[model samples]
Target: MPRTQVTGRTGPRRALTVLLPLLLATGTPLSVGVPASAAEPGAVRLPVMPSRLAAGASCTSASHEVATATPWEQRSLELPKVWPSGSGAGVKVAVVDTGVSQQARALAGRVTAVGGATADQDCVGHGSFVAGLIAAAPVKGVHFAGVAQQAAILAVRGTDDRGVATDTTVAGGIRAAVDAGARIIEVSPALADRSRTLTAAVSYAAGHDALIVAAAVPDATTTTMSTDTPPRSYWPADEAGVLSVVAVDAEGQAPQGSPAPRHADLAAPGAGVIGIGPGGTGHFIGSGASLAAGYVAGMAALVRAADPELTAAETANRLTTTAYPADVPRLDPYAALTSVPDTATHGEKPAEEAVRLPEQHTDAGTTRRALLVAGGGGALLLLVVWASAVVPRGRARGWRAAARNRPTGTS
Candidate 1:
């Protein structure tokens, strides 16, 4: 049987006017796939993992292929620069999706199920994949790692065993995550229908100071309804207090067939992204706005860990406002962690005072280069000033000397 595609709205809507040029200017390569020959001998090539299984399909198997090349998303996000401030330690991020597997190696000893054992079991592997994106630890040889490596994952079931989700399940997941004291809640599935239950659940989470991050659009699959469907809002994401995230490719373009949301707070790398699956030392490839939401949730954990004093709303504001500005602002983990919030431009009321974070550890080479540039600029300015002052005086003195030499005889 063909795998069931997780789908809702379809068709791309908006172009990333400035994001593509910014990415290209940085010269970060845009490919996520590592060729089979690039892998160690005897390592199998990674396969595309399914978001959901067809009615009676077998469970997702362990992948033996390990991605050795650094994923483009990792390079683009520049997570290493942000880690010096915090690695998301002490932050509990709730993954409300198909469920996270405890068997995933990278996430070992960090996952806690919310309701029951079912929430810890991942038959479809989608939740585990999402979880890995958020908090997977660094492995010896693999180049892939999660955003907040020290963060903990709270696994909650927003979808059934086969990875099908409904309004009720997702709403319940939010409430459960909030009640469990998860600071950051990531909702993976994007439903087409808007439910009062989901809205209230989001409000409940907000009231409890839980940051809810959700997918702005659904995952694209072969089973998606149609490519011509008009863009519309997705639930939970469209709700207030929820951070709606859209997925962009390496080139900052939305993946084909993945409809753009009417409104998205941030954009993240989601297309052709690589991550670990349930019970795998190897990796799997997945895509969509849902994956993008996972990235945002991880970054939120980092922010919360670094500055526990910031309210959930404040944390969200920091992430969005500090992002690389574009149609939908691109997620900049380093900026979110390091940049001071400017309440004026955000139009939000100022806090008691601007909370300044400690100085971040930057690359020595980069710092040295910056200092050199500053020194050079200062020297150039001094030269310009000296020339401006001396040239005029010298010209005036030469004119006076010529007049003196003329001895009152010249016209």
Candidate 2:
């Protein structure tokens, strides 16, 4: 069955307005794709800023050294708390982006190159960086720990030379991952076009109960040039059956005045994030909905680990329910792991017959005094009436006796 398509209110023109500021400041379009082979025809490749690690040609032996971490490492916010150790160990997370490097020491056992018929290998470093965010196993010597340290990743390359991810290539990569039995699918790419073939593939993944996470597209046009609204549209992410995510900072806050309705469902650490840069082990810090999407993907792995039987809808519900409400609230890990349905009903009750509860009685002494006062007043009134009646009758009798005595005396 075809899946439902969620149409976002933020169209292309508005996106351009919001994105114009960054574009003008950078003085060029942000190239975002890394293709496997020669550039595809008519594909626009945006120049992705290189990673800090990219300066070094080969992996260093010292990159494998173990190191102490920060408090974030101990908190569930940094790692998957719901999934037990080794639970998601075998589960593969298929990341459709630039391919992962086979020689990266951190990805030694965890990375699986899923290059097939659809897309090229990781020519640019964007896909590998996302892969690291999702499942980079905790290296003793590494600076950061991934969200799902044990979850395996299948890297599917989809970008072209202009740093653009095409609709056809992206759809092909998604289908490939589903066919490969990926338990979870993470997509950071949002193209300009929305096709039936692409939507159907995403729907198929959801129908098969696979959790999909995607980044909300940002604005693209320069805002300084015009008073008119700029383009602010994002495809695929705005599509149905995909959990859309918005960017948040380390303090757990999203951007201000972010386009409502089309904003991400959850927020995660986005600002000042440290990850591998293009083609090298360089550390790159970035802020965007893409990072937020990665956090949701990690959380989804945790959810699946906790309840493997959960459907895509149910899993989404858990994530949405647990998500801490932010400016553009993204997914919440603690809430998703522990949220329940709210059964509360609202509105006032209808008027009905009033029912009274038992009232408190006075003490025995106080009651006795009240009764005595009432009894004594009644007794005194009765006594006074009786005395008055007797007195009257006695007076009449005395008068009658006096009259009789006087008569006798005369005789």
Candidate 3:
């Protein structure tokens, strides 16, 4: 798939202008700053989830690396299922987050920094943690490498230590990954609303047959009992053409009882998950849906590796349909690639065909001709789905805004 540039302000001033009054009327902060909007008391915040990779002591002769031999090895992490042979070895998984530490032993030769966005330096160790979870190499003592150590990674820094991400930077990172030919895009950060730039960027990536995965809102009741505000909703997850993932415990249980939306595609091991830390020294117990999303992304790489012809949507559906629901369905990596139905299909209940071609063509560029031709149809279909949800709500809000500004005095 060819890369296309996405343009447009994510949060328009007019909409925010109108929404601000209502927010203030409800006793919420309406300040013109992002932090202020985020800092409002009881305002729900996205979980600072990290996909901890390798953090345990290395047993290798190498000094900085963890000692390969340790008691942790005996009791260390185990793959939920056997790593599928010939799974996602050559495919690339793009990590869109804080940034990665290029010096880490497991990812030394595998990390590619997106120019102008973030170098291989990770100030807060967040990006490195996410990267390790997706494709960390096997340590001499540590038995479990990541889900796909053979997969390459493109690290696009979307946030820093302070935990902030602007839509513009994130959108640029998405376009950069698609332009560079990324097969699976892992977006750990969540946007607050369905902004134009984010929605378009997702469509643009999906048009190119790139699978986009992101974190869902955290389980409010399970972890924290904050009631100052309503439970937060995650964007990109809520948007069309993207798969939203929620986290589950080691026992394969969702964090909260909150039912996932129709868009909630899959669940992965999330709570108390361990992975590599900065400098490749030791491991840490990370929590939240971020790691779960990474696990799904790695599994997605394997799906793409197994069948290069499968579209992103198809890959997602395979994962979703085959997922084992522990109450809610959790991703089952092996079943996604190998499972097939045993029934006839003359006019039976049509199995949910995952890949639907696009309906319109917007000139992203000419370089990705093969991708454009094959994936454009599916891309257009996703666009229609996106429009159905966004356009009507926008028109209704516009009318409401106009009414709010109209002169009320009798003429």
Candidate 4:
């Protein structure tokens, strides 16, 4: 899908503005996705939150080198293959979390903070890290690349420097992000309860064809007290139209000791991820469902940049339908970018093959069948050659035996 179509909200979007407020008072306060036990009941954010390697690391240079940076997450997301089509240029992605720093190297010239939280400042650092994962400009030789390098970041600070914010504040942040022309809004916080204002904000964003990606489901085994309360589930993500992302580790399996994400609409690498820090060229390491959500948002931006005509829901459907693993449809940016069906042939009823995944991104079945065909052909050729050589040898041996027995007396 190339960036040719103009996107506008569908008919249902007009109704969301009317229908959203009704939901405001209906939902309860279980909006925090982070297990209260794992993280204090604060900003409802990603589950794969990373720990700081060095809180006091210096950032005196133009580009900071995080020696302990892990590129595995980027590789697993297959970013290298996805960059050529579009680096999310012309798409606005809102990072509605802690404020993003104006001075960060990766986002130096590309960030704009909306509303009145902190102007381009991520003192808590979570928002900066998440922003880096989404759109950090590539620095050669540093092994650093964001999912959508050219995507601009609209930093909407819903949380404070302590990584804490009231639901109302976060909800306002969401609304501001929508007004800032964000095509994709990445809400990184979880809440202990649903805020009607927040739900309304999310609804408002959807009304504009803006896709909201959030991590709303907590692991089933996540607990608050020793009494074993269920894992946290939050708003926006739990809301009707949001795309919920779940965290997977380097192995693409459930992270150790964490509860399995049962309600996740998709999964991504969230553990041990490295991201850009707010102050300098340095970096911070944290993993959580937030990282995965950010990655999905960045990918969504790519889809928008590649084809701006797709509606938010259609965009989301494309993501889920085109994702790999078939079962979970894990985010696959390359396939999403290159697997566009020809518009001339894309009518109401098109051939399945014509609309199917790009040949380069075929499933394992295709490769396995190819291997089987090649192996069968090789085995048949080997059998034919063996028969040709062995039959003649057997005949000659038989003739020699007969001559040895009869010719001695006859001669």
Q: Residue by residue across 63-108, what tens digits does model 3's lDDT show?
A: 2223232212113223445364544778988877767777667777
| Cα-lDDT of candidate 1 | 0.80
lDDT value for candidate 3?
A: 0.61
Worst 10 residues of 1 by lDDT: 11-20
How accurate locally, in lDDT, is each candidate? 0.80, 0.56, 0.61, 0.66
Query: Model 2 segments beyond 4 Å from truth?
Result: 1-87, 116-121, 141-143, 218-233, 251-263, 277-282, 338-411
**Candidate 2 overall Cα lDDT vs. reference?**
0.56
Off by over 4 Å in 4: 1-65, 68-70, 218-232, 257-262, 341-411
For candidate 1, lDDT tens digit of each residue in 1-411? 111123333322122212222222232222234322223355444566677777887788788778888887898899878777889999999999998999999999999999532634799898999999999999998888999999999999998888888999999888888888899999999999998898899989989999999998888765442365666789889898899999887667777667757788899988768899899698877777889899999999999998887889999999998998777888999989988655464456765856543447356776788789999999999999999988898897874643445556567
Which wins on TM-score, candidate 1 or candidate 2?
1
**All candidates in order of lDDT, best leading:** 1, 4, 3, 2
Q: Please state the error at residue 390 of candidate 3 in Å.
A: 83
Worst 10 residues of 3 by lDDT: 57-66
Q: Relative to the unseen true structure, what is the Cα RMSD of model 1? A: 12.1
List per-candidate RMSD values in Å. Answer: 12.1, 14.7, 26.8, 15.9
Q: Top model by TM-score, which number?
A: 1
Q: What are the TM-scores, per candidate, against the unseen true structure?
A: 0.74, 0.60, 0.62, 0.66
Residue 270's lDDT in candidate 3: 59
